[model samples]
Target: MIQYLWFDLGYTLVSTNREDVYQKVLERFDVFRNREEIAIAYHRADKLFMREYPGVLGKDSRAFFPWYIGTLNYFLRLSLPIEEVLEVQRDVARECPIQWKAFDGAKMTLRHLRSLGYRLGLISNWDESARAVLARNGLDEELDEIVISSEVGIEKPNPDIFRMALSQANVTASESLYIGDNYYDDVVGCQKVGMHCLLINAYGNRGVEELSYHPIITGIQDVAAYLGHPRVQLEINR
Candidate 1:
C-alpha cells in the first residue's frame, strides 16, 4: 500500500557522527579539550540546547557550538569573549567536514526500490547543507521530493512538517511510509497523521525499553525492500 517512501536524511539516508565531528574539529583547530572531555561537554550542552529549542536546532548535535561555547564560558570560569565563541563556531564549520557517508546498502537499495516503481522522497531535520550531501550521494536527482527542517521552518515530531512532505509528494498520509531513526520525530509524528512509520534503528537504539511500536530495521535497505523491492531475484523471475 505504500505509494511513496520518505527517508530521513541525517541518520537514515546519510550519516553524521557528532562525536567524530567534534574530535575532528578540535584537532583540526588546535583546540585544547581532549576527546573524552570534549565528548561529554558536547553531549551535555547538546541536551541542554535541544531541550531549549528542539524545532530550531537540528540533527547535527554540534550545530549549537556557538551557544554552547558562550554558555560554557560562564560556567567553566573562563573569561572568554563572544567574539572568541564566534571564532570557534566558524572554525568548526570550516574544519569539520560535516561529512556525508551514505549507509552501506543505500545506493543499491534505492536503485532496487526505484526499479519496483515506488516514488522516493526525503524528509530531514537538517539544514541547507543536506542538499550538498544528497547531491554527493546521488539522492538529489533520485528523490521526487526533498524537505529539510531549515527550509520548511519546522523540525520533526511536528505534524505540520509531515503534512508538508506529503503535500509535495502528492500523496495522503495513508499512502506514505516514512522512515527515520528517531522514535518520537519519525514514528510518532507520522503515526499521528495516519501515515505508516518505521524506525531505522541502525544502532539498535531502543535499548532495553519496550517500544510501543513494532517493525523496525537497522538500515534503509530494509525499508526499501519492505516498501517495494521484494528482492531482485523475484522480479527477475517475473
Candidate 2:
C-alpha cells in the first residue's frame, strides 16, 4: 500500500508555457508560426533533451537556453541564428522572469492526497528557485518535504536522491510512489529504489507508450483516480 507520495516539480506539478514565451520572442524577428505548432515543437525538443541530454536543464541558463531554443527553432523551421534567439530570450527574461505556475488541479489533488493520510514530498532536479516557485504557487504548503538537486548535490535517475527523499520522509521505498513527467528520470530512478511510479504525459506524444512497466496519466488530477483504483488502466484524458 502506498503511504508516501512524491512528485517532480517542473512539467509535473508546475510548468511555464514556453510556447507562449517563444512565440512572443519569434515575433520580434518577423517569424510567425502557429501557437499549437510551436507547442508541439517545444514538446519534441524537450523530450529529446530530457532523454538524450540528461541534466542539461539544470545548467546555467546562458548555456542551456541557447541550445534548447536552437533545437526548438529547428523543429519549427525558424532558421534563425542562435545569437538572435539568445538575445531575445534574454530580453524576455529581463522583462518578465520565467514564472512557474502549478498545473490546474495540482494543489487540489495534492491536498486531497494529504487529507487521505498520504505523506507528500518533492524530489526535483531544480536550482535554489524550486522553493520559491512552489511557495509562489502555494504548493509548498501542501508538501511535507522538498529535496532538490542543488541542495542535495544529487539528481534523479540516480538512486541516491530517491533514497535521500525516502530517508527524509522516514518511509520505506515499498510504501512510496513517485510521479513525474520524465520517463528516464523519475520512473527509472524511483524504480531503482524499489518505489512505485507514474508518468504524466499530458501531451500523449512523449513516445513512452512502448514501455508499459508503470502506468501513465494525462495530468495530476488523474492521480486521485489511480490511487483509488490502483488496478484500473487509466485512459489518457488528453
TM-score of each: 0.67, 0.89
Per-structure clash totals for the candidates: 0, 0
Candidate number with greatest TM-score: 2
Write one digit per residue (lDDT tens) for candidate 1, span 1-238.
Answer: 7788888886677765555655554454455565556545544444354445554356554675566676554433345566655665567767565567776667677777877878889888877888989988887887889998888898788889899998887898988988876665778778878989887764453331346547778787776556544653322211
Residue 100, model 2: lDDT of 85
Write one digit per residue (lDDT tens) for candidate 2, span 158-224: 9999999999999999999899988888998999989999898877756454566568888877877
lDDT of all the models against the reference?
A: 0.69, 0.84
Predicted candidate 1: what Cα RMSD to the true structure? 6.8
How far off is residue 90 in model 1, in Å? Answer: 11
